[model samples]
Target chain A: MFAGAAAALLVALVLALARAVLGPTVFDRVQAANTVGTLAMLLLAVIGFLTGRPDFLDLALVYGLLNVLGTFAVLKFFRYGDLGDPGEDEEHHT
Target chain B: MNTVVDILSWGFLLAGGAFCAIGALGLVRMPDFYTRMHAAGVTDTLGAGLMLFGMMLQAGLSLVTVKLIMIGLLIFFTSPSATHALARAARARGLQPLLATGKGPSKRS
Candidate 1:
């Protein structure tokens, strides 16, 4: 069952990769990349079970947190041209 | 008793995998980015939740189950925030969503 789930996740990862490659805009690419990160995290967990190493769940948890952070950081950079920029609301402080 | 748990775990895992695949298909087939975001949301939330739930059943009251729950909670809280940020950024940058009126975003591929 773990093997089956892993295979299906691999298929999903490939499809998401195709979107990332074929994306017409940067936003599309970012979105696809986010999806890919998510699929990869799930795959990691499933493969851990398939290989009898439950320790991989810790890795999966870390990956999930990173995925969310990375997505937000990239989007902020794309929007404001800088990650540290506080946007218009805090421009006065700078 | 053990057999029933195993059966239920397998079923959940299978259903989760199927949902993940279908969502990825939608990601590929959707006409635009916003629609694709909708599809990806399915994979992020439903796919991850169900699969983790299945794994929890298999773990059967262990620290592994605790870690799984932590992961689920992280995804549950952050996925929507990321999606919302992405959509807001895309819109602010003038990437209009495709509307039903047949006039899609003016930006071309």
Candidate 2:
């Protein structure tokens, strides 16, 4: 069962990668990249279970945190052209 | 009891995998960036949630299960934030969402 899940996730990851590569817009690629990160995290967890190595779960957790941080960093850079900027324009919308 | 657990795990894993695959398909097939974000959201939420839940069940009351829950929580909290940031950035940059007419792109002034 874990094997099946892993295989499906692999296929999904490839599809997401394809979308990222074929993007007509920057947002599309970022979205796809985020999806890819999510799938990778899932894959890591499933593989840990399959291998009976529970320690892999730690790695998955770290990866998930990194994924979010990376996305935010990239979006910040894209929006304000600098990660340090407060994204003031972004705040006005919300 | 063991058999029951096995069955439950299998069911969750399969369902999660199916959702993940379907979401990825949507990502490829969706007409616009906003729609594609919706697709990826599906995989990020339901797909990852179910899969991690199954792993938690398999791990039972152990540190592994604790770690799995932590990972799930992380994804739950961050996925939406990231998606929101992406959408907000796109909108702020003047990238308009596709309209319902499905005819052509429209920008908001």
Candidate 3:
């Protein structure tokens, strides 16, 4: 059962990768990348259960946290052109 | 009792996998970035929730189950915030969502 779930997640991961590759815009790639992170995290947890190693769940939790942070960081950079910006009104240029 | 638990766990795992796959398909087939985000939302919430619930059942009342719940909570809190930020940033940068009427690029000249 765990193997089945992992297989499905792998399929999803591949599809998301396709979207990331075929992006018409940078945001599309970012969105796809985020989805990929999510699928990978789920995959990690499922694999942990399948292997009877619950420690992988901890890894999945860490991965989930990092994925969100990474997405936010990338989006901030895309929006402000810098990682640390307290200024409220930076120029809005795509 | 053990058989019952096994059956329930299998059901949850399979359903979660199916939802995840469908959402990924939508992500690939959606017309634009905003639409793709919506598809991704389905996977983030439903797919991950069901999978973790299934695993929790398998783990029973233990620390593993607790960790699974923690992971689920993290996903629930962070996913929407990240999606919102991505959409907001895109909009702020003049990235107009695609309209259904087939109108040409909806950006200011």
Top lDDT prediction, candidate number: 3
Per-prediction TM-score to the true structure, in the order listed:
0.92, 0.92, 0.91
Q: Rank the candidates by DockQ, best first.
A: 2, 1, 3
lDDT of 3 by residue, A1-94 (tens): 8999999999999999999999989999999999999998999999998898989988998999899999989998999999998647567744
For candidate 3, give the docking quality class from DockQ: medium
Candidate 2 residue-wise lDDT, A1-94, digit = tens: 8999999999899899999999989989999999999999999999898898877788888888888888999998988899888656565676
Candidate 3 Cα misplacement greater than 4 A, ranges: A87-94, B101-109
All models: lDDT?
0.89, 0.89, 0.90
- List candidate 2 segments past 4 Å from native: A89-94, B102-109
Report residue B7 deviation for candidate 1 (angstroms): 0.7
Per-residue alpha-carbon lDDT of candidate 2 for residues B16-59, written as tens digits (9 for 90 to 100): 99899989989998888998999998899899988888877788
For candidate 3, what is the interface RMSD?
Answer: 0.6
- Candidate 1 - CAPRI tier? medium
Q: What are the DockQ scores of the candidates, in order?
A: 0.79, 0.85, 0.78
Task: Kindly state the number of residue pairs that clash in model 2.
Answer: 0
Q: What is the lDDT of residue A1 in candidate 3?
A: 83
Q: Write the per-residue lDDT of candidate 1 for residues B71-104, one digit (tens) a residue.
A: 8898888888888989999999999898775577
lDDT of 1 at B81: 88
